[model samples]
Target: MQDATPSAIRSAGPASLETRLEEAARYALLRRLTPALRHHMIGALQPLGMLAAMLERRSQAPAPDMASITKKSNEMGVLSREATAACVGLVAWITPKTADAVSIADGVKDCLGVLETDLALRGFIAVNEATEATALVARAIMRNVYAAALLAITDAAPGPAEVIMQSRQEGDTQIVSITLKPREAEPMGIGGPSYRALDWEDVEALAKAEGVVLEHSATGAVLRIAP
Candidate 1:
């Protein structure tokens, strides 16, 4: 039988080789960072301080728009002043290190945490009785974040894709599932296996980190999560 692997069929040149390696590296890095950042942000938001700051800011403004909120937060020399302060407090409580690495990571995590919590509290998500609704919203946000990060790192688009979200309730326990399908054919000159290859492990990791079960097959991918 002839080898079906992509490497057996094509020879990659210098530029294409560099691009492929860079894309793979970026995908791997984002996969690693997503869960860690999510956890850190969640931890940063646990303290009442960040919430209090958001509330205070909201109270002061007649109606805070996204731009206005972002502007005000930037003026404070942090993504969200209250969230940043809260993150610093938490970091101090945990790690006393004030190194640049620690500060930058914590700052970014706190900003993301505040943004996520704010969106949830603002009813941007349809929190229906069905758990699937919530999971869908979460999946959408995470995918958006993932796409944006990928673009930032690679200067390449991740393109539009369909994400499947499934929810089930049995007795009192709920289960959720999520899957991502590329909207377009995979690019040529990429992935050692084949241009049609999909990053199944990356998708699975993202879904699992979000507390969803992800399954993929020849037809497409499926995701299930609980409320």
Candidate 2:
């Protein structure tokens, strides 16, 4: 496992401190708005919800349309995975002692487990080989990095995508890099451009809030979270 030794001066690029702050502002607003937005959305979709329920009931009582049953089953399965991951993370965060050296790979694995259903449906693959860890308090930062990379990758490429996360230190600079390598030259069945750059500004905003800086690469899109 990598140690937590890092340079006193952390480096971030493209996004300046001011830009990161703005991002933080937006993120904060979004978080506050999410609950209300979700409630309103559900309220607006009540009719569709009722119709969906009717269809689901019909699908169950009879010999069930295998496709529809499978879809519903898959959705429930995804929810379970998400809930389980969240619980594990919460427990980890609340635990008093977790030994001195923790496995960064384990943390990313939990994050991947949470997104497994969506990644699988999109034909994407996530690989974690991060054999490093910082202090227990910094675990949340690593999770955020994995999550941001996952979102960028999902948008950049279609199914069969590839991502790798690892941690290492260059001299006093402790760096954790999440690299995304799409399977195809051009992303298939996605709305945006096939090979759009990953937005490190977004990640920088999160890092800023968490007290960190990051360097984001436009090509290949490596997110470097300084420790």
Candidate 3:
């Protein structure tokens, strides 16, 4: 018998987030672009545009061969990375500062939403429960936003930070660990202390949202959800 279980789908790879964001920005710019200019821009961005459409279509299809899908997915991942790099390069060359600021801001927001949705999909798989999946997805999405906000606040903020989720079917519990490494040590500052303190707060809030009990320790953070 075929295993009916819904296997977890890993993230869309490193470039997935950035690529989606760039695509959003490009689309926004295209919309505002004059017909003549837009035609040229669209031609230049054909590869990225096609890849974006492919991803969207693939996402809607029923699960095909896992191995095949995964292989294609990885290819798409590579394409995403390349697309983002190209987009960044273009952005650097073409200064949009004098352009419509509102459109740019809106594009950024739209891109963020797309990225958040992609991340949430991963989070949903990380947590396998039906009732709590949405909550877990929401928490995951918020974590990304929070991390971004933290980064903006301080360029030197410690990074390579990650949110790790652990689940035990036997105990019917889920634990989410948020690991933080300080960018630099300051003389009695919020760098280390704040990170530690925030972990507990985040865990508790996540627990409440997901109907799970969370715990934190010196090593990392954990969110325990009872089945």
Predictions: Cα RMSD each: 15.7, 12.7, 22.3
Off by over 4 Å in 1: 1-80, 83-159, 164-166, 171-173, 179-198, 202-214, 218-220, 223-227
What 10-residue stretch in candidate 1 is worst by lDDT? Answer: 123-132
Whole-model lDDT values for every prediction: 0.40, 0.53, 0.37
Pick by TM-score: 2 or 3, better one: 2
Deviating ranges (above 4 Å) for candidate 2: 1-103, 131-137, 158-160, 184-199, 219-227
Q: In model 2, what is the error at residue 7, expressed in angstroms?
A: 37
Q: In candidate 3, which residue pairs get closer than 3 Å at backbone N, Cα or C atoms, i.e. clash?
A: 158-183, 176-223
lDDT of 3 at 176: 34
- TM-score of every candidate: 0.27, 0.48, 0.25
Give candidate 3's error at residue 76 in angstroms. 15
lDDT of 1 by residue, 1-227 (tens): 86667874456666566555545544553444344455666665555456558756775787757676666556555435565766564344222123222222232233344333322222222122222232123423234223223222222224333343334555444343333344554343333211222355445444444455655554333444344
Residue pairs in steric clash, candidate 1? 175-225, 176-224, 176-225, 176-226, 177-223, 177-224, 177-225, 178-223, 178-224
lDDT per residue (tens digit) for residues 1-227 in model 2: 86544442244444456666646544543443233334434544454456567567968684768787677666666655665555454445323224343345666665665555445545666666664554233555545544555555455543456767676656555566666666763333544322333355555565665565566553244434444
Compute the lDDT for candidate 3.
Answer: 0.37
Model 3, TM vs. native? 0.25
- Per residue, candidate 3 scores C-alpha lDDT tens digits across 1-227 of 66444432235654465455544443333332223233334545677667667766766778745665577778777866776665553343234222222221232232233333222222211121222222222332222322222222222323332223232233444333333333332323222221222233333433353355545444344444443
Give the per-residue Cα lDDT of candidate 1 at 54. Answer: 75
